[model samples]
Target chain A: MRATGDTWPHMAGAAAQPVRRATVATLPAVKMLRRALVALSLAGTIAGLLRMRGKGGVPPQEGGWREVGVPPQ
Target chain B: MTTPIVGLAGCGVTGSRVLHHLAAHQVRVAVYDPSPALARNTRVVRLESAADLMACDLVVLCGPAPHAPLTEMLVADATPVVSVGDDLDDMQALLALQPLAERHGVAAVVGAGMAPGLSGLLARYLAAQLHTLDELHVAVHGTAGPQCARQHHAALGDAALGWHDGEWIQPPGGSGRDLVWFPEPIGAHDCYRAALPDPLLLQRGFPTAQRISARVSATRRDRLTARLPMLTPPHAAGDLGSVRVEARGAGPHGERVSVIAGVAGPTAELAAVVCAATVGQLLRHPVAPGVHALGDEALAGLDLLHHATQLGVRVQEFTGVARATSW
Candidate 1:
């Protein structure tokens, strides 16, 4: 993961632990607030995906998820 | 130095065009899809899963949207995502990451396809000229198949919401509109609000717009208008899709000036050009922080206008900004 210098608003309570915030903004958040954002992002994604799945929308890793750059000859 | 690698999901029409463009530019390109037969490109990669996208410097999602969740996982540090299809989970996820992307210098361009992508682009263009912009109207109607949702998908359950009338208004109930859009190749295609004024992205990307909408164009007027309430999430339609958008504003002397952008063709080419235009523009300039439209900063110049014109997108400027002028 690339280090986002300061573009993101780091979560609400993340200003205090500047070291932790600096150390881990990637998946395995070093700070708790960063971890919380990741968790929420993940949870929202799951809920969004599940909602679409109900409508027969494409599920992650399904056949539609199949990569096809070329059409059949 | 090696070329930047880009992984494209769903190599259908728009995806393929993007792949071809990237390949032509000598950008190493890989793809993730279940299907075997694909388009002819320089570095066509066969992937076992979407995770393959993680390998590239940039990832352009061209398939259905439920793939949003994958973004948090697939998009690692530094790698920004550009979503091209009906699904906007990628855009939402990107928005969630906006502060990071801006602060850390990571680049994530959302809705980088035709409608949402170019719609965002148009937002940039209109917002630039306005003195005190309040409202912007956008429309779209150009795709040739059912954009229906894949079966059993649940992420699509959310309704279509656009920033409008001050805040994001997810209008309830479906109601068709009697709109006449001037599309390319064919003139004056019928269109209605498939979703609400889709220009909602403007709120985050372009600060000037009070509202903007890019809706679906139909063959006949009011034929496909859905009740705002009935209008659910943007499900796939069974037939081809066509789109047109007009950016309207109140001129200084109580006059309205508008810019009309019309693109007609299969989804991929348009998506590719728009995405390419978005990337091409972004690469050339340093985009300011705060969410932005495709045309936000990079896409306003003559290059995009020429490229779009070369590809058959018509962008016209009118004297008055009036919804009444639209069909």
Candidate 2:
């Protein structure tokens, strides 16, 4: 599945987890935790929108516009 | 008491919403999505594959119809798959996993999204109201913003097919009867015809409904409506919007009932709401073993929404907590 692309401004490249696309995952437990939380949080934030994400079975609803009360991604 | 952990196959819109709901109640989740960006918030893990099953009590398969193999792989010895996509093909795939699920003491609940999700609850709800329900008609109106639609437009193309009458009927996209919904912002809007009454699972779940049809009168292209389930070029692109389900039922003495429930947000946010409630119900209830559907006693319809409402999700229903009185 295609991960979130450079949709939102300033989101294209941030050096928190070194998002290596195309390459399969190779993170240890600690980094995986951080990556896992951030990624899942982002997923929660963009649930509805990503439901229809590109055809790659990626996040169907990715990026922006979260539910009113739910936390931001 | 903490709800048992849930395993999410897809962390897209619907999956995220399920996570959001669980998080509100301090529910921990173990998810396996290819997208690292999406699993950043919850108790997500980097699992090898669906066969791993993580350590979750209930497993929910979200997003559009993912590869059948991916779905089956997730149904390991002890995890039940609460599917968001349902069809004959889906049923067949799920049935293949029954032995595995049963072996692990897990039961699969198929078709657990908004249409199947809420509509299933309505079918059970209305069936309990009368000696017997005659018919159930569901009309959906979805309008997503342009930006959100641009990225994941293929979903609008999925045709919703369900049980109707004493037989199976594939009504054209715009072929179902027109309907009117009493929603929050969009008031009294017309609803187009869908494949059938509730999601595919309603056929078995609803007690005695003679016919059921699910329709959509989305603000999207009318021509693309019927082609929703077909292979063709889309008529338009990118526009996120809200979706509402209007259910019209006929009971004894011709008792007529119409109820509408839906989510309003940027497409992604709404998708999260759908997901949150789904996974939450899977863990909180007495999830039975074997192949289950959305309308099963586990995810108790509006009762799920009631849980969602307590956690601050936005839902609008005719009666129950979502009654117009609060609106």
| TM-score of every prediction relative to native | 0.63, 0.61
Model 1: residue B4 alpha-carbon error in angstroms = 1.8
State in Å the error of residue B92, model 2: 5.5
lDDT of 2 by residue, B91-196 (tens): 5566566567677676666655545555565455445555555666655444222322321233334444656568776654554445344345544454555433
Q: Give the TM-score of candidate 1.
A: 0.63
Give the candidate number with the greatest TM-score: 1
- lDDT accuracy of residue B215 in candidate 2: 60
* Every candidate's chain B TM-score: 0.75, 0.71
- Show model 2 residue runs off by greater than 4 Å: A1-73, B1-4, B36-44, B86-92, B95-100, B143-162, B177-179, B188-191, B194-199, B219-271, B297-303, B313-327
User: Please, what are the lDDT tens digits per residue for candidate 1 over residues B1-327?
Assistant: 665677777776567777777666666677887755563443567667877677777677776655556554544455666666455444565567656656655556666666666666545555556555666666665552224223112211234456676677664222234455444344455444444324546566566566755445443312333222223443333223344555556667867665554445555566677776555545545455434446555434424545544444444433333345311
